[model samples]
Target: MTKHNSPLLGSHMSLSKSTNYLEGVVNETVNQNANTFMIFTGAPQNTKRVPVETFKIAEMNQLIDYHEIDKSKLVVHAPYLINLSNPVNETVWKFSIDFLLEEIKRCEALGIHLLVLHPGAYTKGSLEQGLQQLIKALDLVTDYESPVLIALETMSGKGTEVGGQLDDLAFVLQQVKKPERIGVCLDTCHLHDAGYQIQNWPEFKNNLKQLLPLDKVKVIHLNDSKNVCGAKKDRHENIGYGQIGFDTLVEIVWDEELTTVPKILETPYIDNLSPYKKEIKCLLSRSFNQDLK
Candidate 1:
């Protein structure tokens, strides 16, 4: 659920690298004066997670309250290796399903209600078959009943990755038994890299309304791409420093169709967290200036 009062903006803060995983993620967000962001429960490429103790949960909730960030609107990115579309290896496929199902439970436990997932690649099968498997996995996870909203992320179309096309995401949702349990998180870099022009938010919104309604888009990975549109590159650059110019990025955040959804930065990291702070400052200042006009 989005808050219409302000633009929900924040970045992906790393827990693995932080000295204090739980509190550090929040502190980093507060350091940038951002209200919303995404986190990998563990490393996205590896299936490892820090054991969440009771104290961590209480401390995290305290910080969330102190910072005034809503828990429901928070987003979690699933691991990179969890691939539901692996048609060749049954074991890997099963692991993907199990990890995802467990991921929902973990989110529920922590009171984080939204989880973003990459619809996996079709490693050894056709796109059609891969989508079917993906849908099946989603159905199983949400089969019983779960409050955690699983958001399938838009991909960069790298290699045989399953969900670069908006239509592909829509199709997968159409087949899910519990459609209400799922949502979509559109990544700006992925959208541009997958051949859609980032400047053309109007057309994109029109298409979204026709098939996957804007209401179903709960989160946006606000990023600038290092590569040009249609380059199939997944590189993320600091906002205003990449192919997505600062002015265009301003236009992106101000787009009315996207105003209500939460926007997150998956931008490159600066060791001291200076880069994120600067990016957040840039977004707020640019948008504030637009209000004066």
Candidate 2:
């Protein structure tokens, strides 16, 4: 039997102009010996996409099954250019909502369970209005009929983006019309940059207890931060190189509460996937050692 306790560790696979994005993700992730991974449905900035035909969907599912890939652990990252919180730009806001709806439909088509989405930037509005707009947009776009869960990502506190704060994300969860279809993805880099100090796991535990149920945390981005604590910058360094550092990053991923959650690396990709391969080995080695003890 496959071990139920092993973490679903992997990195986001690039999907540049590939005719086979879904199969590419499965092949690359399985090659890394990772149990799970993340991918964008299309180009993150543009709406251009590979046409999803009946054969494509069938092939994608067959490929995943052939690799013994766990569908629930597979994550579909929503495009980056969406701005559901843009209160001043009605055109952008409308597009964001529509784009989001389409993303969910794509997830459904691919049979992927979780969709990771940045909650979006406020652009030109108060934090209150920004959050309200996010809530409103979510309410508009959510579909109770779809099985896909939208996992709202924590942001680096840069600019006017929502979800830098845990409560900000929780509030959206509380207000959204379909709470059952929504969850959270905590990015370690964003958490540190947003000033959450999750490296201090005990305090982080306390914070997690205060903020939301641990089960509601559907995903974790395990990147280290390139900036200092409370810096509000979103730059990502490789696993051990930045502020989160080696020991803490290892410990964070191995924590029992997060072990079952899918942990993905959105780190700066270096040549030939060596960085992620090494990071996956490093983190899992520590975890295996801890299990032996």
Candidate 3:
């Protein structure tokens, strides 16, 4: 086995209903020897949420503390159904706001502080209008007192997605009333799909620093893309098995400045089993496992 120097590395663990949801996720993280992880408060596709109280939060915390996982880096992702960028439907827009607030409350209950969210799609309206609406929605959502910070994810330019560009995120940050409650979750796959040539890390980092504060980057979805740069399709490939090769990914993951930010894997599973343990091991050892597919 390769000895490792771990960064704040982890993957998105599923909330298993078969066992204690909270404890189950935490155990998966520990099993992978990961120090931090991300999960949805409920299923990511819909609004169906089990009550937080029943998730065995106390036992889960014990497990987390026992494993020495950093609670602050543990993230809860908002559901896919909530689109804060919806421009035409007022009802959907309001639902998005309400649902996100409720997710924050859930995160508070779980004692997790970071919530990763996709900036959402316009669907039927112009990009500018969608951004304005998104900024408005965030202003309302962040007005309340909460320890949970919403980390807006960079999106693939798929369909009407509003956050594919750094300019879009920068605009939202500038316009939102509560910047303190907002942070950014950079996705390597999304950045590549949306045409940011991140293989040249120095150039990309320099550009990102100009647009967004480095401190505002709270989480990174360290995925490799199934599609090429400028593809605009959001397909995630397993690390080293995708277009973004292993060395580039290792460089990004071990960048000195981002050591504190949790790097998450949202890679595709192989044979219905998680590839995270193998992937995480490969990353930590700084070795490319060519057999990982």
Candidate 4:
């Protein structure tokens, strides 16, 4: 196996409807040869909460030891109900804070190093105001001893999403006192829909360099966009199966500068495992082969 210094390559896998059990999910990813993976800590809907289970924690540790997965390679996506930018009421905001705190606690117990979050929709207010709300909510959460880094994901600019642009995200990070705890998760589909020209390597590199430091970027959501550039849509297609194409991904995966950042696919699952395997093979081929030269 080629040992690349870059973060491990993998996809976000789903556990059952229950957030309490993660053993099967971890095992499935390991069986798929994934050294790194992402999972949602709870159900996607707004109702119901699943408390973390003890056995799942034990299984997670066992898998990590047995598979020798680096503790830093695992990531957990917070639940969908969390809207850091929501200005509805104090109760809602409090709920969001509690949800995130619980998520951090669970991740800490499991030794997961990254938590990817969507920078919430602002609904009926200025983007700046919404950002302030997000910062406030984050500030209220107590810190954990886990090495986990909280990554705010870029959005597709649909509705009132706060982190659609690099500037918006940068603003939030700047306001937050604990800079070390804050990082970025760049979603390819969202970036494309946000009007970033990622097809060209030089342009891509320049854009990223100008917006945020490469080191501040901790995670990459490797998905293709069903919508065109600047469409402000969040539809995700399989790798190379949508508008972004395989060549563009090749450029991204082989970039020496971004090799240290972990990349996880959020693509729709195909009927069988072939699609995931094929995508991984494609990424590996592009990274190691000289055909692109």
Best by TM-score: 3
- lDDT computed for candidate 4: 0.77
- Rate residue 235 of model 4 by lDDT: 96
lDDT of each: 0.80, 0.81, 0.89, 0.77
The digit string of per-residue lDDT tens for model 3 on 1-293 reads: 11135788999987877866888888888788788888887888888888999888998888877777778888888898889999999999999999998998999999999999998889889999899999999999988799999999999888999999999998898889999899999999999999999999989999999998999999999999999999999899999988877888999889998988999999999999899999998998999888887
Which of the two, 2 or 3, has more lDDT? 3
What's the ranking of the predictions by TM-score, best on top? 3, 2, 1, 4
Q: How far is 226's C-alpha from truth in model 2 (Å)?
A: 1.2
lDDT of 1 by residue, 27-144 (tens): 7787788888787777788876766553266877899887778877788888888998887778989999999887877777777888898899988788998998898888877875
lDDT ranking of the models: 3, 2, 1, 4
Ten-residue region with minimum lDDT total, candidate 3: 1-10
TM for candidate 1 is 0.91
RMSD of each: 3.7, 3.6, 1.8, 3.8
Where model 4 places Cα greater than 4 Å from the true spot, the runs are 1-7, 17-21, 142-146, 272-274, 287-293
Please provide, for model 4 over 172-284, each residue's C-alpha lDDT reduced to its tens digit, 9 standing for 90 to 100. 77788787888999999999999888888678778777767778898889888898999998899877778998888777766778777778888876665435556776676
Clashing pairs in 2: none
Residue 106, model 4, lDDT? 75
Q: Which candidate leads the pack in lDDT?
A: 3
Q: In model 2, how many backbone clashes occur?
A: 0
Candidate 3 whole-model C-alpha lDDT, 0 to 1: 0.89
Q: Residue 45's C-alpha lDDT in candidate 4?
A: 56
